[model samples]
Target: MKSLNHRTKVVILTAVMFVLLVAVYACGILISEEAVTGSFLNAKRPPCLEHPFGTDALGRDLFLRTLKGLSVSITVGLVASLISAVIAVLVGIAAANGSKWVDALINWIIDLVMSVPHTILIILISFALGRGLKGLLMGIAATHWCSLARLIRGEVLQLRSQQYVAVSRKLGKSSGWILTNHLLPHLVPQFFVGLILMFPHAILHEASISFLGFGLPPEQPAIGIILSESMRYLSTGMWWIAVLPGLTLVLIVLLIDKFGDHLRMILDPYSAQE
Candidate 1:
């Protein structure tokens, strides 16, 4: 380990974090409904050895419930980020490869989307789409692609000016062939890093919209819904109800962000050399 390069060490660390994150998500998914079922006898208990996160007003174990909520949030984030990344890649390629007029039009659309406040826009979109899982997914996916699309577009333009690309064009390679053989391969790093970074934003937005009552339904076990319901109990000194779960969400986001940053460092040629 002492002989390892900085990039190698980062890769090892990132792998460990990735495993840890996967475990958390898996744990949440594996938890059963029975684990979080409520009973009046156990209601409103403060944190204890038996129930680490304590019980809520309905007597459900906050720990299990929180895990379940986190699982839901992670699922939403994964799906939304994937869709956004696809959109970003396609739009980016189009803007970079198409006519000047086409590029201008795409840029204008990106700017228009970015100009809106994300939370407000998500809320409006969610409401319009009927305010459930589908609505939230669409809203988050739609709003999160602008910056990444711009990055891909710029990268494609730069790649187009490269000697190898010009040589490929001279060899009579079709545009689609060049895109698949050259452009897309070079874009793998940017695509993955962008996707990872988008996750935190997606998760946060999902929580935010849900908390505002415009994302998921009340019946679903979501962090946003958990936080929203905890409001009334906070006045009664049930601080643990919201605090622990919220902290968990923050910690997960920070972990994911750290993983993305380290992975980016390892993948970047210049940074890896250092």
Candidate 2:
């Protein structure tokens, strides 16, 4: 009967997304290809009860492929976001609390990294690192840390100026302790927001790179791979394969983004409580 707070709303929405994702994945895994009602005689079919997303050019179940794609996308988002946030925190502390020269140097590097065209940079880096998930992950990680670093740096800077940090300095608390205990806690809200925001970017980049035939392998079931495969069938009237999968990818990213925005609002008590 109680009205939902922003946190409650975000939590509920996120849980629903997760459940849908799990259902799609579990069904894809448990339901064998033969058990799927998509008929070989009707390959590349449009949306129907037997095949909600229809079939691909080869008569493979597009719906099932979509579930596998979603799982792969989630893998990219989770790993890249975790790596980005951790690096952001560590580098941010060094930039904030280290010598002035160190701060200047690291800040310059962050700016430089962000100034490049992001997608192109990712592709170049991925290609340079060689192919597959290793390259894709490295490419994503290479570019994703700057915003989080800036956020954590700002929090560290603010915390560094507070009276408690000043007192800690006078008390001879090690720089490590001040950063780990005092500054890091101050970064919690920013860190969480940065993390949630990072999810969509990472997923999109992964999908984009894969779609371009640069990230995940062709045989691997991923949203990008589905879309890429669909391209060849587009002129042949198998639009649903690409279209439906693309829509699913967009929907997932958009829902995650909306939830991230809600989380940012909720976690920043200043904004909600204001």
Candidate 3:
């Protein structure tokens, strides 16, 4: 059937994307840190067969550095998005199921958080937490939950009015029982799609905060730090120093974003039919 074929294609694409991501992560882990470190003899080299991404001002291998940085970005994005998604689900369920006063308070908090520019809010939180890995994770996890929470809240509210939910209520099912058995099961698709969508945003924010010198320590070879360092040598005709790594980061972000879109389409029943 057409529907079955479409589903098969979706599954194949998802699997491919997952494999690509895993491969990238594996490369990062397997790459030698020594290979990326500075060497006076190789310093300031341009892109060539021997060094594809070229050597930086300090002779650090840009290719390996970029891969390592990307791996760190992916790791941070994964962890932060997972935490944010969990927070969103919990807060959303509470907002939809709690008393009117509780709902109002949660909604108010969501609105207040959303009112601030996300980058600025994240910076403030990161700074407040002392601007390291923990700070970056907390900042991203705290700020990125609002939109997903709102989505989940709306979904929960709609589900609460469904016929089956009404019947469950009439049959003396407890709120917890209804939520666990009915609501949570129905939310799996939305949860996964939202989680995937959050990844690109989290990665970008982590890079942004680091670029601004408010994230991961300078010792870490984070993508943002690499890009930031490259900015200083751009005027010296070292175009490869910035362009290659920058392009790599952009490419990764785009791929992750496209993967999320594909996932959303596959998970959304109406969209999948189209």
Candidate 4:
């Protein structure tokens, strides 16, 4: 075979990663409570052939629990990130196209949001919203838009200054018409790349908040909950419960982050030529 080029290699790798991630999510969805249901007789069993990840204190299969938890995390992340990305695009466009006062106000809000640490802000928001899935989603979606909004605002401003845009303005095109015909199309790439990049961050935040007891409820099979529960059993020589699942979470995050990078490279015209 002719040697694979860099772009080809990246494409293949990205495809594999995408498929694997989807498979994990699908498996998590396909698996029901029965896969994780407890059997006291098997409680606290160490890793073995029959139970690859062993059983937790309640004898729930750690593997299945981890998958279910991961699925929950991914779902939460996907929804929150999509919301955040939409908020970002809207805020960015508004700031760029609106009056100076409106722009200043939006910028101030962005700065204010960015001023606070994400974890702290998420915790406060999640707590105020009653600390469940809804709250967690709101918290994450509300917090993650600042940076992307700023980027989009800059891009829009630059595009607005271009000769074609000025010509459109001189030709009596309505602002809305110009925006729809010109600006929005250019923003598609940025929007998608930003959305993909935000996924892992959203996932991590969901897990962290849940671990702190302010996101998902304890009964929900979330990775954070699994890890938090494992804390109590770690001292009793049960390591698989936490270690395996924690590692799996990290691996998934890393894979997602890598996939985002690959996607960015593919989508970026400059990068694609290299």
Which of the numbered candidates is closest to the native, going by highest TM-score? 1
**Segments of candidate 4 deviating more than 4 angstroms:** none
Best-to-worst order by TM-score is 1, 4, 3, 2
Pull out the clashing pairs in model 2: none
Q: For candidate 4, write residues 124-225 as lDDT tens digits.
A: 988898889989999999999999999999999999999999999999999999999999999999998899899999999999999988999999999999
The lDDT ranking, best first, is 1, 4, 3, 2
Q: Show where candidate 1 strays beyond 4 Å.
A: none
Candidate 3 lDDT over residue span 82-138, tens digit each: 999999999999999999999999999999999999999999999998999999999
TM-score, predicted candidate 2 vs. hidden true structure: 0.89
178-251 per-residue lDDT for model 1 (tens digits): 99999999998999999999999999999989998999999898999999999999999999999999999999
Candidate No. with top lDDT: 1
Estimated TM-score for each candidate: 0.98, 0.89, 0.95, 0.97
Q: Pairs clashing in candidate 1?
A: none
Worst 10 residues of 4 by lDDT: 1-10
Better of 1 and 3 by TM-score: 1
lDDT, residue 180, candidate 3: 91
TM-score: model 4 vs. ground truth? 0.97
The better-scoring model by TM-score among 1 and 4 is: 1
Q: What lDDT does each candidate get?
A: 0.95, 0.82, 0.91, 0.94
Question: Judged by lDDT against the true structure, how good is candidate 1?
Answer: 0.95
User: Model 4: how far is 14 from its true place, Å?
Assistant: 1.2
Off by over 4 Å in 3: 1-6, 271-274
